[model samples]
Target chain A: MRILKFLLVKEFKQIFRNKAILVVIMVMPVIQLIILPLATNFEVKNIALAVVDNDHSDYSRALISKITSSGYFRLSGYCNSYNEALVLVEQDKSDLILQIPPHFESVLLRENSERLFIAVNAINGVKAGLGSGYINEIIQQYNQQLRSKLQVPGKFNLGPTIQIQSSNWYNPNLNYQLFMVPGIMALLVTIVGGFLSALNIVKEKEAGTIEQINVSPVKKYHFVLGKLIPFWILGNVVFTLGLLVAFCIYGIVPLGSLITLYTFVMVYLLAILGFGLLISTFCDTQQQAMLIMFFFIMIFILMGGLFTSIDSMPDWAKMAAKFNPVSYFIAVMRMVIIKGSGLYDIRGHLLTVLGFAIVLNAGAIVNYRKTF
Target chain B: MHSVIVSHLTKIYGKEKKVAVDDVSFSVDKGEIFGLIGADGAGKTTIFRVLTTLLLPDGGSASVGGLDVVKDFEQIRQTIGYMPGKFSLYQDLTVEENLSFFATLFGTTVAENYELIKDIYVQIAPFKNRRAGKLSGGMKQKLALCCALIHKPNVLFLDEPTTGVDPVSRKEFWEMLKRLKEQDITILLSTTYMDEANLCDRIALIQEGKILSIDTPANIIKSYPDVLFAVKATNMHQLLQQLLRYPERLSSYAFGEFAHFSFKGTPDTDGLVTYLEQHGLKEVMVKTADITIEDSFIKLLG
Candidate 1:
């Protein structure tokens, strides 16, 4: 108990003394919560457009007006020729370009023409694809209107005859925050759990106080536990803070029980912190720890499904992710928040995390055992 | 009575190739100040770590206060105080906080054993609220000593405690150890500083994972088996070369301003003066030099 007290006081003092921890634990999550969601989105907006309208007809003007009026794009300039439109696009002044033929209305009226030039920037591939699809849908609507005037059979239908029903589970509105908050919570915990704990332990080793503890009456397990427990609790606090901020700011309420979420969080924290302790055992300096942690954080964020789905990965990578504790935690958080999954739904994840906690920690203890 | 004892202690590190502590064995009597004096990587810290129960020797056994370091590691830890070479107190914590934390860890309060560390503690007690990381090297050293002694352990292991500290603080720290000795607690210290060997009741001079000699400082110096002389001349570097060329010289090493040399036979000052003059050496003076532990170390290495 005294060892525990001593370690806790020391850990708390270190957290306050070091502004780096404050920045990572407190400020970063908030900034990422607010800014990342706003910046990193699949939804495309504010597309700059250039038009090459050689037809000089009412129909082309109306089509250009329709494309520009959707609030998704702005008409940046009117090019006199296709070359000017191409130049604008190559210069990065416009993201998309539309070209009309010299006899656009005449050709449409004479032979029901089809080839139309729609150039879009593929640098942002997903955005370009979605924007082009949106434009295609608008032009299809315009064609339907023209067909109605021409008295085409089965035209001008307000709705499809084959009806399809859609339903959303858990978060029925499909709020982006509802999907992101839990992952953010898991990510925040990992940064605190994996990086901070490793650096903290390795720093003590570098400073030589580790020798003091080695010689003290404190058992190796006691010293390791003393260090791990405080950081583990701090990880929980940061996780909870992330949860609360996500809820208050974005209305991203968890569908599962808070107790259940925090329970898995607690178990997940052990595996993460154990991994950090294992890293500290192998590393001699804080700089080395930091470099290794940078790699860990990158792997955690990428494979943990923060921005991509692990299921989409190749067979080997997907199998490898099974042992990743970050993946399990992120999966559990998503299951609990988005699917309203009960404890039974996440039992497999819990067992995996528990296995990791036991095995990794045992490995760390064995590797660091002080047999000279 | 022996407070610390070991038998044929050996530690080999890699695949049966490297021996960090090879067949090393020594004992420290109760209430005595013993030193393991050696240069860096001479296995002093390894010996200290093994004795403190932080490490288990590969092929030998050690007992402190009659408790085996391996079998009774928990009890051994409870009985010893260790100050590692590096300044390793919780840098974020204030001086008072670091003291209290370590004191509480040993199940004692600082107030209970204030007398044990009062002299060193009082020096930095005025700035008790200052963070340990922000304090000077000397203050950190004093605080580390206070922390180590807070528990009032039966034995203390200080591993190269004054390696980077300034000379004055080093002097003060040794004086503090002298006072601690009067309290009748066994102290096992390690240092690379040869001058500090004199301060210990007995020192084991070690090099290359082997103990060259272990004895009282006076006895170790007394056992110099050669006529040692310090030679100085106008050409200091040339004078060293000239002294080494003499056929009767055993060993000659530059010590401070003069080159200390050992003789193989009778003192031949007149013959040496004639040889130096022939070598164009001016103001040649030869005197008996005090053999330091460093000289003894170099000779033992040779």
Candidate 2:
């Protein structure tokens, strides 16, 4: 431990001496946390709604006004024929067409019911699906309004009503940053902590100081730890600063226990740092280490479910994500912060990350050559 | 007991099988300043690397301070200091920081070895706060030597330490090594400059991964089998080309102020003088000269 302490001191001295790297470390994650979330929203909006009305009646007009008033959609046009609606869609002016059948008000008054058709441009799957669902909900409310105006009995209202209500529990507002900020925190930590530790030994090799270290009595584990701990601490600093930005700028407060969040962070950092050390042992130059790190980091990010849902991915991609440590970090970061989950909820994830840490670091220590 | 011992050491690098160090063996007694004299790629650095436990021998074994290099490497590392051919100090750290860090790595402090490095470190102490990369070549050399000696190892392996320093710094460094020798620290260093071989108690002249001779400086010169001669002319460059044409020229090379040559057999000095005069060479002087390490090295290579 004495040797390890001195080694850590040296690592810290070397790390802080590079003012450019320190500046990059302290400032970058905060900027990313603030700016990146705004551009990655999944909530579909500004859907172009086109309406075709055969009977220009109060009831139909009321429904049209109701559809336009909701902010989820923009009215593209009111057309006379379906072909005109099709032309609007082809022109990219409209993405949905709501058609009111002939004798719409008459059927609504006599039978107290009516049916409408919607021709949606399905090129953009999310916009098309959500647009049609919004129109359907509006018509359902209209049907209820007509029955109430006629003072109809409760029999029809009770006939077959399955009131489906959903609550977007953790993020009720569905703010994308609330979802993205935590995941981006995972990415920032991986890039900073992983790349820095990966370059540590290889940089020594390039500078030739590694010969001095290798010919010393310092154990391989001590050397690897000295390279790892500083970057791990820096990773946490980046994580905490990002959380602070999420709270102050985006008004986001993690619902989970800070204890749970921090615990997982320690384990996740261990895994990432070990992976970095593994890369350092295999590479002889910092550029080679950086290139190999970039290749793996890219794979880790793309397959880690940071930007995309793992469940939505193809089977092969999902299978590949199972091996990616970054995916576990992102999962737990989101689970603990946005979902406010407890340690009990993330125990499985914690174990997986811990396992990765042990295996990768053991490999690093074993693979490092005392005589090179 | 010897400070370091090697037997039949061989190191081969690359899939192309370049023999870096081949079938080499030598020993250094405690407190002796031993030199490995060779040009670049002559495997002097390779021998130092093998002895210092920075590299493994492909075929043979070495021991430092009575610990086998392959089996007891950890213990061997504690008793040795290695300065690589290049300046290997951290460029980002201050000199004091670099010194203190290396000291700490060896489980000691600079204060503990102040008596050993004080003479060298005092010269560069005022620039302790300066980053190492900005220091001049001489200062870097002093600083590297200070760091290597901070732990007070039983043996020091310095590979071409004065390769690029100014002559003044080079002389100062040798003075420091001599003072280190007073403390009974075995010094094994490699140098391409043949003149520096005289500074050591003994040297091994090596080339192309082979050792040609190992002896004290005086003995190696006395062991020369050929009669040596020094010849000079007005056109030194043309003189070099002309001397190579001499039928009896055994090994000829341009020494600092004159052309030092030797012959396969004793030459008629008056006849050589006549040949140079006929060639329109002016200020011609021909005389027998004593053999130096450089001349010996050239003769061995020839």
Whole-model lDDT values for every prediction: 0.86, 0.88
Residue ranges of candidate 2 with Cα displaced over 4 Å: A44-164, A369-372, B234-237, B273-285
Tens digit of per-residue lDDT, candidate 2, span A166-230: 99888898777788998999999998889988887789889998888888888777877788889
Could you tell me every candidate's TM-score relative to the true structure? 0.92, 0.86
Candidate 1: clashing pairs of residues? none
Local accuracy of candidate 1 as per-residue lDDT tens digits, A1-372: 767777677777778878988888888888878877666665677788898998989889888889899888889879998788888888888888888888998889889765578899888887788888888878877877776676666667655654358999777886776777778778889988988889988988888778777666666777788789878888988988888788888877788888889889999899999999888888999999999989978987888777778989898889878877888988899998888788988999999999999998998888877331
Write model 2 residue lDDT over B6-51, tens digit each, in one string. 8899999879999998898899999999999998889988788788
In angstroms, give how far residue A54 of model 1 lies from its true place: 3.4
**How close to the true structure is residue B298 of candidate 2, measured as C-alpha lDDT?**
85
For B1-302, candidate 1 gives per-residue lDDT tens digits of: 99999888999877967889989889999999999998889999888888887777898889999999989988888889988877888888899998988888788899999999999999999999999998998998899989999999999999898988999999999999999999999999999888899999999999878989999999888887777888889888899888889898888888889899877888887788888899899999888889888888888898
TM-score, chain A, per candidate? 0.89, 0.85
